[model samples]
Structures are given as structure tokens and as C-alpha cells.
Target: MKSPSIAKQLKRDRAFVLMFAPVLLYFILFKYVPMFGIVISFMDYNLFKGITGSEWVGFKYYAQFFENRDAFVIIKNTVLLGAYKLLFGFPAPIVLALLLNELRHAIFKRFVQTVSYLPHFLSNVVVASMLIMLLSPSTGWVNRIIEGLGFPAISFLQESEWFRSIYVLSEIWQQVGWGSILYLAAITTIDPQLYEAARMDGAGRWKQTLHVTLPGIAATVVIMFILQIGHALEIGFEKVFLLSNAATYDTSDVIATYVYRVGILQGGFSYATAIDLFMGVIGFLLVYATNQLSRRLGETSLW
Candidate 1:
């Protein structure tokens, strides 16, 4: 009992389905297939014994994770770091796009965009190595410059307080330009006539941007915000893993790093899986809530 419009829409969506077939296959193979393995989180996972042979101990792994001394510290660190990035990194690209949109010279804008975007293509290992070299107290160029400017050289990578700052700054450097690509695209689609009308009414550049440009991209912004909420807990592991040392463990030891240590290094499969499950569930719930909030607030939602 499909409606005519529904049937017609389905017919029109055939090309989209065809285009998405490979992506669907990838999800089925890698993503959904892994869900079947989540059962180990409830079992006493043994490397010697296969998943099928593992003994079930329902909730034991979960309890272990909750009660572990390191659990709270790791969770707190992860959440705090993630929250910091969300607060600062999330809006950075939007601001960049706005500023870039204001540029009258195409050549300068293109050069700036190119320079900004280039960092995103660099490997985490390279970025970390570069940071380490730059921030080295004695031999690094940054420290040399600081010392030359009549300041004592700072051990940036070693200090606990500096860890988060370095992490956040490097992340912003790596991703801001790439992130702005989407925002710039959104800005480009805004109606030219609206800006012209604003000008005719004697609106300044700031006023036009605030009224026309921002509102035009509000939906794009909202949708991206909701998606970012979904990944709030799942911070980038590569960058942190590469940059962090024992000295900065308090601030940098996030869920992913903990998982790597416990699961991969220590072979505590059940415990790691339990932690992963907890994070995944919480992250999903947050995304859902934010999506609902977005829908309620205005004209932008994933649904």
C-alpha cells in the first residue's frame, strides 16, 4: 500500500542507492559485523579460548570497568579533553569560513585556504614529531626564539598543563582548514540578493554577515553540530597517542589510549570491550538528544 509519491520517490532514488551500494557493503562488512563481537564484553574473553569457547560472565567486565581505579581518571580526562575541543575546535572552522567570505581578493583567499588545508594531509606521526622538535626546551626553534625574546625556554610537551594546550592547538591546526571547506560551501549557497538588499539598506559588512550569511548557513551548522555531538566521546586517538608521554598521562590518557593499553597490550579483551560499549552507548544517546533538540529549535535535523 505504497502511496504514488512514495513509489515515485523510490524510483527516483535508484541512482542514489546504486551510488551508496559500496558504502552499504563496507558498513555491513566492517561496522555491523563488529557488533556481533560485542558479546565478548559480557564474557570472560580468553586469547587461548576462541570467542565461541569463552565463558559468559554477564556484567562482570562492566563491573570491573566501573570499579577500576584508573577508570574514572581515564573517563574524566577523555570527557574533559573532548569537551574542550568541542568548545573551541567546533566553531573555529565556522569563524574561518566567515572571515574568508569577507575577503575581496581571490588570490590571497586561495593562498590562505591552500596553506591552511595542507596540514590536514600530514600524518599524525609527522605532526607529533614536528611538535616535539618545535617545543623541545633546548634545541627546538620555538624555544630558541622564545629564549631570544628574553623568556626562559619552556618544556611544552612534558608539562601536564601544556599537554592539553598543545593537543588542542595541533588539532586546530590540522583540521580547521579542512573543516572550513564545508562551511565555505554552505556560505557560497547563500543568496547574493540578500547581501545586495542589506547593502541598499545601508548595512555594513559585519551587519550583512551577521544577518544574511550566518542565518543562511544556520541549517548546515546545526546538522554538523549534531553529528559532532555523536563523536563527542570518540576523540582522535592517533594524535594523542603520538604526542603523549608518561609525564602527560594524567591529561592525555583518553579512552582510546586506555583501550590500546588494556586490550592490545595487556590482552584484557573483555574489559576493553566493556569500556568501548559504554562509550558508544553514551555517545549515541548524546547525539540522539542533540538531534531532537536541533529539530525542536529550528529547521535543521538529521532525521
Candidate 2:
């Protein structure tokens, strides 16, 4: 039989199309449309002159950024923060999903999931305030415990050494449950007979999880990992900005906050745009490389 015409197919799937229309419009309006501003990175970007009227100065801002004294430090801080978050945060959801899968008590499992997921919905501002209150060297619970052990209270937010750790841990705590939702959904798609067969062969829970559950969700994990790698350099601005102070700038300053300071605050639009565009290109390259590597090593890839 001949395939339905385009119009007929659209009519048949009208409900699905209606559901997706808003998302498509959103990306066009917020994501893709604004990409045109990238050209400002190569221009002087006068506020009144605008894109067409601005003087073109190709590579000048990029060169200046690279030549700056603080460039290396800024880049290093961004990379290390991204790497640490990826290293710790990537596995957290997977571990949570596996543990949750083993739980037979529905009420307790849902309670744990609900508690873990609640932090993800909190605004960055609130989370930052909570962190400050919880880690205060003077009256914070964390420091209280430390003092209880006869050790001196440590100012976690003020210290440069603790910035990355604090950021990573907070991210994991906020996102682990929400992230695990995908893995849990993937686990449900696995055939039950596989688990039953494993049981028939005297395979324990751990063995079933290792051999069956993990492999079942391996594709989802790979896709998620690849997507995470794509955003390795694109850390969110609000939480880091709210959490960081001058004392912690050495470790906490990242590309997003740097762009905000330079582009929005200092009015070096071209210079800041150049830095952002450069990082975006690097992120794209990382995603491409990771996807290519995944394709070669396994059946899973973003493509």
C-alpha cells in the first residue's frame, strides 16, 4: 500500500503535533533565534550602532582574551569545575536508580524519591542561601559537628579549595533523583523474563542488576553521558554566581559568570561574546568527539 500523503499523515498525528508545537516554537524563539547574536563577537558591538553599523574587528577580542593575565586561571577554574561535576554527578543518578530498583517497599521508595527530588525544584537563590546557612562557620550545623569533634570550624563558602566540592555535591543532591527518573523509566522497559531467568539460574539481586538491569539501561546511560559531555563547559550561571565570593574566585569563577560580568556589567559586549563563542565552539567539539567515540565503541550515539 502507498504511504499516506503528508497532509493525511499530519492529520492522523495532529494531537502529537499539537503537543510538540510549543516546544518547537520555544527553541526557535529562545534558542536558535538568539544565535544570530554570535556575530557580535567579531564586531565592536556598539549599543547604538547595532550589528550592521558596528565596526568589524575579526579575532581582536579573542586575541585580547587569550593574552589577558587571568585567562589561564579562568579557563582552568571552568574546566576543573566542569570535570569534577561530570566525574561525580554523572554516576549519582545511575546509582540512585539501581538502589531504588531494589526497593520492594513502595511507600518508603516513593518517600525517598520525593525527598531527593524536592531540592531540584528549589531556586538557585534558595539553595545558595541554604548552603550558606548550613555551612556557616559560626552557627552552621556542619561546623557545629566539626566543633563537636574538637576540630576548628571551617568556612566552606569562603575557602577557594572547597568551592568545586561544594558545587558538585550540591548539584548531585539537587539533580540525582530527577536524573534517575530517566534511568528508572529505562529499567522498566527491560523484559521481565530476563530477571526471572536470572533468578531461575540462582542469580542474586546484585548479579541480576549487574548483568541484566545495567545492560538494559546502558543505551540510556550512554545517551545521557554524551549529552552531559556536550554541556561540560556550559555550567549554569546562577548557582555558581550566588555561591561564589571574591575569596573563592580562584576555583569558582567560570565562563558563564565571566561573560555576565564582562558582557552585561562591564559593557565589553564584543570581548565577552568572543569568550562565550569560543567556549561554545569547544563544547560543540567535545560533543562531536564524544558522540564519534561512542558510535565506534558501541551501538549508542546521539546521531
Candidate 3:
């Protein structure tokens, strides 16, 4: 059969198109429009002069970033922190969703989900404060327990070595539950008959999950994974800023915090813009590479 004409299709889906108009406008306004500001990376940007009047000094700021002595350290810290987050945070929601899906008790499952999702609604500042209080070297429950066990009280926030682990764990705590919402929704899309077939074959819950559930949601999982890789470097600034200090700078200093210091605080606009542009390019490449790899490996990907 011949496909309907564009006009006919639009007429048939008019209500749906009306509903989608605001979303399209939002991306065009906030997301795409702001990207045009990236041109500042190539110029000596000035508040007084603005974009059009700013002097063009192409690649100067980029070269300066590479020449700086602390460049390597900051890059290494950003990469390691991003890698650890991806390694740990990526699978957490998948595991939680699967566990929750297996529950036979509706009330209990909902209660557990509600408790898990509440943390994601908390402000970053509040989360950071909670972590600091809980891990305080003095007058904190954790340290008190350590002392009771005949060990010296350790300051987790002050130590560079513990920063990555602490950050990853806290991130998982805040995000895992809310993140699982997508996977849970995907789980509902699987054919119920598939589960019946698995049971007919004498498969247990574990076997059904392995053979039926995982494969059913594999496409959603791959898409989410690729999107996660795209933002691996774009760590939120609020939590890191509140948690980090001079003592933890060696391990906790990420690109976002550094950008806040040099760009927003110190007013080195062009230099900071250059660094951020580099990060954006890296993230874009990550998404592209991962998408290509996924397609090659017979998995779904973001186009």
C-alpha cells in the first residue's frame, strides 16, 4: 500500500503534533540557541565589548590550556572520576529495577521505591552536608563506631584517596532509584506471554530474568549507556564544590569545579570557554564512538 501524503498524515496526527510543539520549542530555544555562545572560545571575550566586538584570537586560549603545568593533573582527575562513575553508576539502576520487578508484594515494592527515589529529589548542597556530618572525624557516628572498635578516627572528606569512592557511592545513592524508573517502564513493555513461556519450560525467576527480561530490555539499556557515556565528563558542580576543599583538591578537583573557579569566579572568560569547549568535543566524540561500537556489535544506539 502507498503511504499517506504528508498533509494527510499531519491532519490525522494534529493533536499529537500540538502536544509536541512545546518540546520542540524548548530544545530550539534553550538547548540549541545556547550552543551558539561557543564562539567565545575562539575570541578574547569581553563583557564591555560583547560577542560581536570581541577580538578574534583563534586557538590562543586552547594552546595556553595545553601549556599549563596543571593541565595533565586536572585531565587525569576528570577522566578517572568520570570512569569510576560510569563503571559503578551505570549498572546500579539496572540491578535495582530487576530486583524490584521480581517482588510479589505491591505495597512493599512501592514503599521501597518511594524511599529510594526521595534521595534524588534532595538538593546537592543538602546531600553534601549530610555526607560531611556523617563522615566527620569528630562527633560523627561513623568515627565514633571506629573508635569503639579500637581504631583511630579517619577523616574521609579530608583524604584525597577516599574522594572518588565517596563521590561515586553518594552519586549512586542519590540517583539509582530515579534512574531505574526508565528501566522499570521498559520492563512493562515486554510481552507477558514471554514470562509464561519461560515458566512452561520450567525456568525459575533467575533463569527467566537472564533469558527473557534482560534481552527484552537490552535496547533501552544500550541507549541509556550511550547517553551516559556522552555526559561522563559533565559532572555537576554544586556537589563537588561543597564536598571539596584545599586538602581534597588533588583527587576531587574536576573540570566543572575548575571551570567555575577560572570562568565564573576569576573572570578568565575566554580561557575557561576554551577548556569547556574541549570537554564538549571530547564528550561528543565519546557518544559518537560508543554509538558506532553499539551498532557494530548488534545493539541499539542513539543516532
Candidate 4:
């Protein structure tokens, strides 16, 4: 039998095509279209003359970025923050999902999930404000508790030493429940017969989870870990920007905020674009390397 013509195939799947149209258009308009602007990184981008008339100064901005005195500081801050997030934030959701799985009481489990997930839905602005209010040295409940316990009130936000801890803890709290949804879904796909077999072999709940549940979700965990490694340097800008100040900049300054300062605030568009493009290349390399490593170590890979 002959296959249907392209027109007939389109007609048959017209509903699905229609559903995907907006998403396709969105990426074309927003994502792919903006890629052309990367050329600005190679030019001394003049707003008046624009791309065509701008002077091409290949790698000048890239060189300038490295030569800056604060370059080391900013890069160190970015890497440390990213590392902290990966170390702490990556496993938080998995642990939460595993604990949630052990809950036999449906109503309490749902209540805990609902409460934990609430923070993820909150805007960064609100979360930042809440953090500020809660951690205030004076007139804040946290300090009040400290004072009541006979210890002096320490300024949490003002201290550079505390910045990483605050950021990582807040991130884990905000995202743990929402991130666990994926693990929960993966858990549901595990075969019930495996658990039954484990039980028949005199395995307890803990043993069954350790032997069956974890191994069953190993592929999902590996994929998620690879993706997390890929995004290690692309930390969210809004929350960091909102929470950070001059005192905490030593710990909180990252590529995104630096780009905003140089590009939008200082009008060094080419320089900022060069820095951003460098980071993009680094991110791509990290993803590629991680995917390769995962493929070699296990059966699961993004490809």
C-alpha cells in the first residue's frame, strides 16, 4: 500500500498541528530570532550605526573582560554559588519525593505537598521580601528568638559569610516540592511486581525502596543530574539581584547581574555581550561533556 500524501497527513493531524503552532511560533520569534544578535559580541556595536556599519573588533571585548580587576572575584562568586546550588539543591527534591512516597496517609501527604509547593509559586520579589523581613536583626522574629535565647542578633543578609547558605537554603525550600513532582511521576512508573517480589523475599519497606525503587528510577536520576550540571552556571538572576547588596556582592555577584550592569546600566553592550557569549559557550560545553559522560557510564542519555 502507498503512503498518504503530505497534504492528507497534515489534514489528518490538523488538530495536533494547530495545538503546536503557537509553541513553534514562540520559539521562532523569541529564541531563534534573538540568536542573530550574538554578532554584536564581535562588533563594537554602535547604537547609531547599528550592525551593518559597526566596527568589527573581534575578541577585543572578550580580552577586556578578562583584564578587568574584578573579573576573578565575579567569576569565583558565580562558580561557588553554582556549586553550592548543585551540591545542596539537586538532591533535595529526590529526598523529599522518597519521604513522601513512604507516607501511607493520603490526606496528610497531600497537605504537606501543598504547603511545600506553595513557595515555588511565589514571585521572587515576594520571596526576597519575606527573607528580608524574617531575617532582619531588629524587630524580626528570628532575631527575637535569638535575643530571647541570650545570643546577640546577627545580620543574616548583611553578612557575606551567610549569603551562600541563605541562597541555597531558600532555593531548596522554594523548589523541593515542585521538583519532586518529576521523581514522584517516575516512581509511579516502577513495576509493582518488583516490590511484591522483594516483599516475598522478606524485604522490609526500606530494603524494597533501596533495592527496587532506587534502581528503577536510576535512569531518571541520571538524566536529571546531567541537566542540572548543564545549568550549573545559569543561576536565576532575579532572586539573586533582589537579595544581594554591596556587602554581599563578594558572594552573590554573578555573570547575569554583571551583564545587566555593563550592558543595560553602563552601555557597554559589546563588552557585556562578549561576556555573555563566553558563558553561553561554557554552558554548552558543560552540557555536551556531561551528556557524553552519562552515556558512557549508563544506558540513559539526553541524546
**lDDT, each prediction:** 0.90, 0.92, 0.92, 0.92
Off by over 4 Å in 2: 1-33, 288-303
Clashes (N, CA, C under 3 Å) per candidate = 0, 0, 0, 0
lDDT of 4 by residue, 1-303 (tens): 999999999999999999999999999999997888999999999999999999999999999999997788888988999999999999999999999999999999999999989999999999999999999998789999999999999999999999999999999989999999999999999999999999999999999999999998888888898878887998899999999998988888888998998899999999999999898999899988988888888766788
> Which pairs of residues collide in candidate 4?
none
Q: How accurate is candidate 4 locally (lDDT)?
A: 0.92
Report the lDDT of model 1 for residue 3.
58
Measured with C-alpha atoms, the lDDT of residue 240 in candidate 3 is: 86
Prediction 1 TM-score vs. true: 0.86
Q: How high is the lDDT of residue 156 in model 1?
A: 91
Error of 4 at 173 (Å): 0.5
Which portions of model 3 show Cα errors greater than 4 Å?
1-37, 46-55, 288-303
- Output the better candidate (1/3) by lDDT: 3
Using TM-score as the measure, name the better of candidate 1 and candidate 3. 1
Cα lDDT for residue 171, model 4? 95
Query: lDDT at 162 for candidate 2?
Result: 92
